[model samples]
Target: MIINKFGFRSNVKSVSLSVMDCSAGMLSISLFKDLLKVHKNSVALVLSMEVVTPNGYNGKVKSMHMANILFRMGGAAILLSNRKQDKHKAKYKLQNLVRTRLGSDDQAYQSVHQQPDEAGKVGVSLSQELLHVAAKALRTNISELSPLVLPYSEQLQHGWSVIKQKIWFLAGQKGTYVPSFKKAFEHFCTHAGGKAVIDAIEDNLRLHKEDAEASRMTLYRFGKTSSSSLWYGLSYLEAKGRVKKGDRVWKIAFGSGFMCNSAVWKCITNLDPNLRNSWSDRIHLYPVEIPEVCDH
Candidate 1:
């Protein structure tokens, strides 16, 4: 609609969807894929930013305190194009997008919320159980992504692993082997929502120190930029010259409403130095020592 502000016609086709918090960005990617399927040569722009104005919640709740510390002030816009000629200029090509939700579960539904208090106070509320809920959502999301990105042999191994795990569970035993996602992606760009969230993903996915470097550095330098956090991670990797042609990058985000969403992209070319973002000047200093409480 803003195109009309520049004198463009309002007759352009549109499809809009609203998703929960950080998950909204990846959800946009999902919808954009649908739009591309319907129209051959269209492009979609997804803009995401954190809301820091009209500051909500001045209370002493721990979640509010954490939110104030984690959510920073920033935004990013991503362009998705399906045009053949555009490929030469595009940085990455869309691979796939997967979204998973835990709305049916009561605990998951109440994990992160905005509600009116009995006294009529309204502010975002986050539960202590959020990590637990997020872990569940993250697992579900990765499960969906496995089929799309995993190699044929990896998928077969995963299938057998699942069956073996089921048998172990039936025998009142536990299966410790979880498929390694490292082989599926060259770089991982996860939401820098919190140190705990990143740590949980690293542990769950069996990722090593370098695997989560981009995300950790993003949080250290930018705090948590909400939906744009994934982009920040990607930027960090880019600025560090870690991305290359044909490499696969995976972005995963966790948001309120216990949602987890993922988007995968394949690099079209080596990152151009001139195209590096704001982090260019400070990239070398990052992955800095982020202490437990680096209150800014």
Candidate 2:
């Protein structure tokens, strides 16, 4: 949870994405995206993350072990600016994104479920089918966002094919089609849900190992911080001084309800490498490849 410390509680409406899955990272970023667009020229402070142990299930042996190995406490705070005048100082531009929710099946939502057992110990269980749900949701979201961002040539060819087949219904009416995301954004911050989730997305998006390094590192360093993981991923880029003015970045996260949320952002300032945070501080102790999982 991120909050403004301006000494006025009433002025701030604490926005929280609780119990959100890995995709919450994207959802929170999308919220910031909307806020920036509405307030144009102002800065929006975004805080996101999750504390999963409080809801852990103790009786379920397999589930509890999985949770123990997969989750860690982590969060992040990011400042976003949308002012066009700030372009000179801006680090990146808000690009295009597509969000989609597939609640057609209750099972998909239940794939990664949280509940209590007979012993009253709460825990989360990830069904073997959860990955399938994620893949389906991602496919739907990409199909919707691809046409809009794809190059004109690719769009024309794909558009004509869809039109000829009366398959416009497949992409929907919003024109969500986008060309390869590589053409529109310089960096990618995928939610650090877990190794499997990250691997799945990397394969699906055709992202290079370097493109996913930030996310993987954050997950290894800080574990799954839920909605805030995406910001941590971005911070990795900033920490390395990789983000430059006018660069475009894309953030993607997954969450309950089997939803895929995305946000596109352009940097407004050169991030300070010396910036400090509870999360980043811990990164120093982490191994570059994979770190041991410790209970917090």
Candidate 3:
């Protein structure tokens, strides 16, 4: 049934995004962008999803337990068109995308990992140190992306701050301000990896409560949908009737390579509010407060 629904073709190259952390979704979108560039007149369907339960492992490993508690099942399919005519009917236009990978060291990779225990159940374990790694990567990614996205005033402040601190040695390596992605994009679909991650991003980016609400709501209601979490956030926006023609949307996701990936898209058409699978269906059941982490 699954095969039939997907309509497998002999010539299609099936790429599976497995074991990648939350950033996998942005990576998948970036891949779609590249494919569209190559197949300029063709249509491309991109699928992103993850199965967290299947990878759950039973062990005393505290790190793996974090994964067991964090991940949840979800998937998304996005259709892209490269034909110039598509501009008239398209729902969104592909804009700039940037991806940055840090922590290539073995220690960084091992900091977050999936391993099996005595019972032989495969599960993911994330070291507490992963937070530090994530922060470092975030800084690196924002540094590379900010100049491209930030306003000149903010960039100048960042530059002067670095110089004042006498950190000239790190001049090009510091990120003093988060890009005003919200200014450039009317909507944001940040990956709902966890409450802490979401909060950290919100604080770092100085996003308003409403700006982070969609991601937090999705995380609470659906848990971590891995690569598809951002779509769920987009669905939330659609449910609220916020997406409109010419509105730009930004998607940001983090993953295993200690990677940070971002995609910018401009909506071409107004989305119907009656769309099925909208996030509103489960919003009523979401906990008003973030739920306590379980040790399952």
lDDT of 2: 0.71
What TM-score, to 2 decimals, does candidate 2 have?
A: 0.76
Quality of model 3 by C-alpha lDDT: 0.73
| C-alpha lDDT score of every prediction, in listed order | 0.80, 0.71, 0.73
State the lDDT of candidate 1 residue by residue for 101-181, as single tens digits: 889899999999776555565667788899999999988987788888988887887777667767845555465457777
Residue 52 miss distance in model 3 (angstroms): 2.4
- Position 197, candidate 3: lDDT: 81
Candidate maximizing TM-score: 1
The reply for model 1, stretches above 4 Å from the true place, is 1-8, 13-19, 58-66, 168-174, 293-296
Off by over 4 Å in 3: 1-9, 60-63, 118-121, 167-181, 280-296
How does each model score on TM-score? Answer: 0.89, 0.76, 0.85
- Per-residue lDDT of 1-296 in model 2, one digit per residue for the tens? 12344564666546776666666656666777777767756766665667776765557567656776666777666666766665676555667768898877887778777777667777777788988998888878877776656566766765666575566455545443334567766898887877888889888777888888888887776677777778778878877767886677877778778788777777767677667644456545433756446322
Which of the two, 2 or 3, has more lDDT?
Answer: 3
